[model samples]
Every structure is written in structure tokens, then in C-alpha cells.
Target: MPLFVAQYPIGINSHVEAIILQLEIGSDDVCMLGMYGPGGVGKTTIAKAIYNKILDHFEGSSFLENVRDKSGTFDGIIQLQEILLRETLGMNGQLKVCSESKGAIAKENILRHKKILLILDDVDKLYQIERLIGGFDWLASGSRIIITTRNKHFLQTLRICHSTYEVKELDDHEALELFSMHAFHKNKPEEDYSNLTDQVICYAKGLPLALSIIGSNLHGRSEIEWKSALDKYKMIPDKDIQKVLQVSYQGLDETEQDIFLDLACFFKGIYKDYVVDILNSCNLYPVIGIKNLIDKCLINVDQFNKLWMHDLLQQMGREIVQQESPKIPGLRSRLWCYKDAFEVLTENKGSDNIRGITIISPKLAKLQLKAKCFEKMGNLKFLLVGNVDTCGDLEYLPNGLRVLDWSRFPSSSLPSNFRPHNLLVLDKPQSPVILDKIFEFRRKLEVPQNTKYEDNILMDSHSHRKLSHQIDYSSKIDFSHSLIKPLSTLHAFMMDSIMDYEESYNIIVTGKKIPKWFNHQSIESSISFWIGPKFPTIAVCFVFHLVPLKDSYANNDKYGSIHNDEICWNCHVNIFTNDHTQPLTLQRDFYSMKCDHLWFYSNSHSKFQRFFRNMMQGDRNLVEISCKISWWSSRNKKFAPVIARMGVHAECICHPPNSVIIDDNSDYFENVDDSSDDN
Candidate 1:
């Protein structure tokens, strides 16, 4: 038995011991154990540790490293079987089994009589296992065979293992300790380098292989060199780590490879089903391709069904795309680097090879491109532009586009000749171009503190033209009309101001009415309703009317900044029914610079049905439903949230016997004059 050479196995002890317990190697029965996880998760290292620990207890032991790679060599499986036979039988020279019959003869005659421990490292295919180990029946009782693979499906399909263990990434403490050992030659960092050490650990993200490679590369380097290395890693991954991760990607087929690249470039952290739908429209078998990726430990789907990949693996995939025409941004299959994507568009350097492009810039800059920039990108399928003001005629758009999520689009309208016949999703949020007339007064509003404008000034009535110059209702009407025509071809759509925690836009709308599609409507903050029996469907709506700041306050520099007095109103709705002791609570945050309403509806009945059952408990008689709404302002100590008019609406299959009414104790809308002072 030969000892394995692992310098620092910080997190492998627990995994090895747990897998050993799972295998129950002490039992008299023959056992086959499998260790599986994503690439570079330390599966082989743990297997090697286990093999070396129990080698002396067995009659003989053999560890076959890199079975997936070695099998591709000349007569690989045959040579592997011969090596296994010679090691277990205590032979001195290499045993040559050129043919299948010869290999089987050696396996059955000499190797079957002894109790042996065999470890197969990095097995990817089922045929490799079949040819290498055949069966446990041929080995003596109490014998054990361990297999380490990236794909769990291979083990299930072969049925060669009685137990399987998934090797997880190292925890924070273990990752830091492991990284410190290689970087600083100790288990803990010195005081001066503590923060730098933490940054390195965060970049590694608890992946042992990444930690090892980076730590070793940065060992004994100065502070300046460490900082430079970390900065470089953001754009380009360490080559040593990328080489290991890229092997799994290389094993994928053509369509699967495309799916992987697309996810790496654009769809990471997106909902898996949503990405699958978009990819399916592009003729990619995302359903099977995603499964394969998961099996290979290249990607993971969390409990929320959102797809996530390790940062290193994602970087590796992007690096692969980056290497294809490294100097020429136009020649790559995917363009995600902001500099590259911007250059490709502004310079008309895009080519037919470009499949996807994402431009996300934090700075406020207008990207002016020639109208024919996308003319050559006929193969483009996915396009996402965020926080970028794109201008130009844009006379032509590719007909094969599947997703066009351009936030803050600069054009007044899409070109007439541009056709998106195959488009599946169109998300143009905070679209200033579509609502040019409504947003024109965003910077010029000078309303007094106590003035009350007529509802028709902003409402959907013909009288809207009376205030056309101050606020154009015609543009709003045109915007709404133009938006409705594209709903037939889209799978999902959203149109609203984009507000994050740090900043908000100045755009505001004065409308206060809910959409007509909502069957029930209310203007008060809280409402109580009775649901009759057999009401199958229910939908909820929330409408908030924003009050603009006074001209005096807006002009003052100290108070003018939106951040100084900006308040984020968080609304919580509590639903009470007669059946349950506790009320069901739903919460949403409203951060629009202007007035906005949120509608909650389900295209599928299952989600609504589940919600209805949980809230109503299938009661046959009339059930009282009460919703209480409250709001709190964020970051404003003196500013209180006042509801000019808040509403909750419920839609169902049939109307209740009694009409919805406000709770007598609730003072949501009563004494409107005093309510403003209370906030």
C-alpha cells in the first residue's frame, strides 16, 4: 500500500469519515461507495485519503486516478483491469490483458479470491465502471470499492454503488484556514495581512481547489502584488483553477455547450424554468442540458429553483468565451464585458458569430451607435442592456431575438422595420422613451403645498388635454395603446420606474385608478370582505398615490436631495379568517418616485388554489376576510407616510353575497385633513 500525498486536507477528514460510515465497510458484505460533487470540490482528495487509511486492513488495494482521462488512452480500460489484477494478486510486473476474455479470466481466477480495496477516481461514464470493476460479486466478502465522479446520474444508471455521498464545499472557517496555510505558511494570518487574507478567501468562495491554487500562486508576495493579483482575478481567473473546471465544460455536447455559455454570460442567478423556456425557443434542449450540467456539478439549482454556479466556474466559462478572439470583441460568441460590448456596438464591430450581449454600466453615459450596428448580428438571440442610454435610429433589429430587456431605452420608439416575431420576453422598465410626454415635466413640477388638482387632469378621460402642456395625457394614452399591441407575442412584460436602495428617479404619474381588469376595488388602506362558498379564484391589488414635495423644499439644497428625506414605504397586509388562529401576512415594499400600483395575478390556477386553501380552509359558509395595511418611512425621522388614497381589491370567480366595507375601528381614510398631520 502506498500513502497518498495531500499537503493540506483541511476539510477532507469529515467527508471521508462520513462516507466511510455510509459505506459501513466493517460489515461482512461486499460494498460499493460513490463520492460525487462538482468539479474541484475535493472528491478525489477525499477518496485518496480514505484509500490510504484503510489500505493495510485489506488483502490488497489499488487506486486508479483520473479514470475519465486515462480511459481515453490506448487500450485504457484493458490496461486498467490488468493493473487492478496485478495489485490485488501481489504480482511483481505489469499484467497485460489485451482482450476482454483475458481481462475477465484474470478478474475471475486470481482477483476474486482476495479481500481488496479499490478506488476509481474521476469516473464520468458508465462504460468506464462496467469495464473496470464489472461487479462486486467477483470480489471476496468484506471487500470495498470506492468511485469518485462528477456526475451522480452515472452512478444511478450503473447501479454500481450501494451508497453515495455528495462532497460539499468547505465552510468559511475551514476555507480561511486552508487558504492561510498555503498563502502565509501557517493556519492563521498575521495581523497586518488579515483583511487581505479575507478578501482572498471571499474570492475563493470556499472551493478548495481555487483556494489552493490562488494561495499557492500568491504565496510570499508583497502587499502590492497581492492587490494587483486580486484585481486581475476579477476580469481573468487563475489559469490553474480554470484548467480543472474547464474539463467538465469540454465534455458537453454542442447544444449543451451553448447553453452553458449563455448561462455563463447572461442567465446566472435567473429562474431555471424561465431560462429553460427562453432557451427552448432558441432550439436548445435546455431541459436535458440543464440536467446534465447539474449532474456534472457545473451548476446548481437552489431551493427556490434559481440556478447558481460557483463564481470560479462562472468566471471560467466567461474566460473560455473571452479567449475566442481575445483581441477582437466582434469575433467572440458572447460579449459580457462592458468595454467589449460597448466597443462592439459603438464601432459597428459586431459579427454573425455574436450570440448574446449584456451591457450593464453604473455610470450615466449615452451609448450612441450607428443604426446598422446590429445588422451583422443575425445570430444574436439574447440581448440585455441595463443602466445604459442607447441612442440612434436603430433602423434594423435582428428577427431572431428572443429576449430584449433594455432598461431606460433612449429611443422614442422601436424602428418601424424592426420586427421581433420570435421574441419571447420584452422587459423595458423605466422606459423614458415610451412615456416621453408624461416624463417631460419630471424636472419642472412646481405644485403648491395645499392645491388640489382635478382627477381628470391625470385620469384616462378626454378632459386630460386641458392640461396638455403641463402634463400630457395624450402621450400616456399613446404609450398605453402602443404597449398593448406587444402583449400577444410576449411571455412576460413589466413597465415601471426602476428604483434601488441608493437612488430613485424624479418621474411621477398622477393617476389613482386601478386597472379595469380588477373586479373589486377599494380606496381606503384597509378593507373587510365576506367570501361566499365555492369562490375559486382570488386576486389582490395595491394602489399608492405619491405626493410631490413643495417647491420651497425642492429648491433648498439640504432638503432638495431625494436621499435626504426619501422614505421607503413598506406595506404589510394581514389576512384574517375564522378558521385559523393566526393571520396570514404578505408584505411588499413601494419605492416609486411617483404613483404606482401592483397587481398580483397568476396565469396558472395551482398557485392561487394553494393560497386559497391555506387562507380559507375550504369553508362552505361565508367567511370574513380582513386586510390591515400599514406603512413606515425609511431614513426619514420626521417624515411620515400619508396615504392620499390607498386601495385593496379582490377578484374571484363569483361575487360575495355582501359588499366589501371598511373596518369601523380603522382610520385609514376618515378625517383626511387630520390624517396628513398624524403621519
Candidate 2:
């Protein structure tokens, strides 16, 4: 007999021994054994240990993990069929679906395997077994199918020629041994801590998972620390094993709290670095925090840095976070997608109740802004925009803003002047049209100049032509390649894409963002890049857009020329060029044609305007550059900004670009009488 090295009482000793007994060549018994229990109850472990013990008697053994988690039902059935095919038949052949049904294939394959031990993990639905192993005739006299499950009725409904056994919890002695190894590193608690150990054992209630967690929680602590833990245990409200496990979670630091919640709610079986990346977005220290979790025994982190928590623990953590701060503003929480964000904001519109908002989810159904709701947000600031149709109709923004990030907005139609003047940080200001609007706003708001309008007009004219060319291309091409296309249709296409992507692949990247290629350098260089003719690409042509400037510098060398003279505006980056499309000066009124692209922005005392041109005709690459910010207060915390995405539009937009569009007063309607307005 193989040694039973595992100390945990997995509760399948009898079944495993029965399988071994039946596997004898002289045994005439044809019996199937099914081991079942709730998730995380050690069914898989028991079956494996048993299988290893008796594999020598059978021709082969097979194991399937997450049979129901795969993409297609047909795929799982085929996988099982292939296993039986190669092992029992000693023939390597792919199972082809003729009439292509899973049931037919399963029926044919099960009869071919003889004296084989098959272990199926996480079988939940009854139909899954019926389609795979419903038939009884296929089993050889000693063949066995050992199934593990969270639902017992799932097996009872199948009602095949199989007897089921419920794997129960460990007894006190077995639980104590498991706990002692983890807690005191001995067979029993240390002499001095016997009383506290007894208290811990009573809380564990003979459950293996609970004992294991409690033991690890108490590991290496002094007697005082152990007493402190015991005191905490006595206060647990539910006194359930899960509640006891949650005590470890409560002991985690604030960062650990956020990381744990994010994992439980957002991802499972996720790669380590991917989790790290998500945590890094919130400027979290995942490395140290994860180690703390592993050491506390609340979670497990493998050599691959893949962190996993017992489902019970995960459920507890999620419930605690949600219940404790159901409505606390700025409390650490997550928005699953842009739609969730919109739903929250829309549901709570006109109230200054929400404290902070994060746009963690990328893909969202398109949303059209209701004019009244846009005008009512008096305190909104932090926003994570997605590249989907959700950004359309965004105009007015709260003036008390600190951060503006449009990296999530995939396209370039966002208005300028969206930046609040007191804004401290601006990231990825790549669109030229938006940049120009900021500079224009800054020039008007900060630096009062009467003659600067003409200079702004000159730049606007240049950008106008480039924009027109792209619009012309869009008009000429099929429906897909237009930039100025209506937001509604784009949203519909996106919705269809979501369904298609979901059906075909299990992986979901949160943002509905299309890849962007245009950058500041590419725009300034007048280099054209195309995304697809189906998608309207950024057109690369330089035109003069208003820019916020620190000082007035002219490209013209001549000090007194009337037409090519130095035109001083709040322009930051230069809009002049060696070659003029016309006379390098326009005699006509440029603002007569409304340029939604024209913008103005301000950064403290300095300002600049970017004259964004057209889409790059070919491929343009967004150059990745890293820079760090130092905070003197938080131990001089320094971190680089993630260069999310970049695009080229035109000239300088000031510090905090004015991306807000003025709303027409006709749309504002009040539920109350005008008495409140008068008051």
C-alpha cells in the first residue's frame, strides 16, 4: 500500500479502498463510485490520492478540471471522448461529430474504455454528466467514474448505476493535527498557550478549512498576541467558521483590504502580474501586501505569484466590504464597467453624494448624455472614460476638478475647455483640436488680447483644411470610416461586438477602446497614420488652433510686416511653418466657420495652444515615455504615469484645457416651481 502522507481527513478512505478492491482482475463486481460534496471540501484531493493508489491495476487514469468552465459543451465531451480513445483503444484518433452530437459520441466512447479510473472535478450541472457519462453499458466490470461536486442533487438526477457518498468534515483529532502543524509547527499546542489553543479549536468547530486558517493566523505569535487573537474570536458575530476566517482579513492594512476585495470581486484564477497591473493602476503596493496576506494564511500565493483565496473567504471579504460602507462616499470600491459608472451617476444625478469614481471597466454600452443631468453635477471631478460610445454628448464639466483623463476615450471628438482652471494635473493631452481649444480659452480667460484673434484665426484655417480632408474621405468611403458619424450607430456596432467577443472568447479586456496611434510628435511632423478604412482614422494635417502660451514669440523674422508679422496670442507651441499653404496669412474671418476643434486651456500661470492637423495617412506609432512624480509628504512617493494612449490634432492648448462646451439654456427644466430659483 502507498503511504497516506496527507494528514487532512479528506473523508473518502472507504470509497478509495472500494475502488482498489474492485480493480482486481479476478473481482467480478461492476460498481461505480461517486464522491460528492460542497466546493472546497477536498473531494478532488481524496479522489487523486485514491487513484494513485490503484492506478497499477487499471490500464490508465484520466482527470478533468473545470469541465463546465470550458467554452463549449461539445468541447468538454470531445475531450472526454479523446481521453478514452487514446487510453483504452490504444489508438490516437480525434473524435469527429457526425450528426455531431455530444451524447452520441459519449455513448460510443464510454463502452470502449475498460477498467479505467476517471476523476471529474467541479461537476455541477446534471446535463453535463448525462451528455458525457449517462450510459451504464460502456463500463468494464471494474471501471469507475469518481465525480466531485458542489451539488448532490446533480448526481441524484443522473441516477446512473452509481452509488454516491457525501464527504463530511474532519473529526476533532484530525482537525487539531492539521491546525497544530500550521499553528505551532507541532502535534499539539505549546504548553503555555494551551488555554488559548482550546479557545481557537472551539471556534474552528472541527472544520478542516477553518482549523487550517485559524492555525495559520495564530502561527508564530507570542502568548499576548494569541490572547489578543482569542479575544477577537470571541467577538465574532456569526461565530461561523467563515466569520472566524474573516478576522484575519480585518487585520489587513488598508492597501491589503482594497487588493483582496478587487481580487475576489473582479478576478479569479487570474495571472499574478495581471492582478499586479490592476492594483498598480490605483497606485497600490501589491507585492508587499500580497506577501502579508500569504503570511497571515488568509490567502495562498504560489511560486507563480498566482494568489488564490478559499471561496468562503472570498465571499466573506466581499460581503464585509459591501455591507460596512454601503453608501460611504470615497470609500474604496470599484466600478465594474463604464455602464456601472453611468448607472451610478445617473441614478444619483443632481446629488453631491458620491465621493469618488473610478472607471475600471473598459467596455460599456453607448450612452447619450441627457442635457439636464450634465448641468447639475457641482462637485464631480475624478473620471475614467472608456473608448466606447459612452463619451458622446459630454460637454459641461464641474469646475472644481483636479484630474482629467481621457485615455479611455478612444476617439478625438472630445470638446476643449473641459479642464477646470485650478486643475493640478493633466495627462495624455494628445489631441490637437482639444489642445487648441484649451489655449484659446486660456488666452481669453487669462491673457486679454484684442489682436490675438487674427493669429488664432490663421491657425484655425490651417487645421480646418486638414480636418476637412479627413471629413471628405469619410464622406466618400463607406459608413465605417467616418469620424463625424452619429454616436448612436457606433454604439449599436459596439453592442454587437460585445456579444460576439463574449461568445467566441472568455477573456474580457474592460475597455471598449480601439487602439490609437497618433501622437504629438507625429502630428507636429505632419505624418499620417491610418487605423482602418472601416474605422475613421486620425487625419494628419497641420492647421492653426489657438494655444495657451507663456510668452509671445513670432515665427516671422521681419518686425514690421503687415501680413507675415509676429502675431502674439496665448499660443504655446509654434503654429508657423516655412511653407505656407496660401499666403501664411488669411484675410477672411476664420471663426465664421464654427471650429469645435478650437480650444483654450491654462496651467497655473503658463499657457499654450496646439494646432492639431489631420489623421496620419499610414501607420503612426504612439511613443511611450516614462516620467515620475515626487510627493514630499507621502515619504516623497514617486511613480511614473502610465502612457495610456496618444493622438495628434493640432497646436497648443493651455495648462488645464477648456474641454467644456457651453450648454443651451433651453434644456434645463426644474421639477419644482420657479420659487426655488428666485430664492
Q: Number of the top candidate by lDDT?
A: 1
Per-residue lDDT value at 67 in model 1: 91
The local lDDT score (0 to 100) that residue 322 gets in candidate 2 is 51
True lDDT of residue 483, candidate 1: 18
**Backbone clashes counted, model 2:** 73
Instruction: Name the runs in model 2 displaced over 4 angstroms.
Output: 1-29, 71-113, 224-679
Q: Give per-residue CA lDDT, model 2, range 233-279, as digits (tens).
A: 55342336655456556657788887777666544444455445445
Model 1 agreement with the true structure over 145-244: per-residue lDDT tens digits: 8989988888888664478889999999999999999998899987888898899888888999999888899899998998999999988888788888
All candidates: TM-score: 0.72, 0.33
lDDT of all predictions? 0.64, 0.43
Alpha carbon deviation, residue 573, candidate 1 (Å): 13
List candidate 1 stretches off by more than 4 Å.
432-679
Candidate 1 contains a number of clashing pairs equal to 0
Q: In model 1, how large is the Cα lDDT of residue 675? A: 24
Backbone atom clashes (below 3 Å) for every candidate:
0, 73
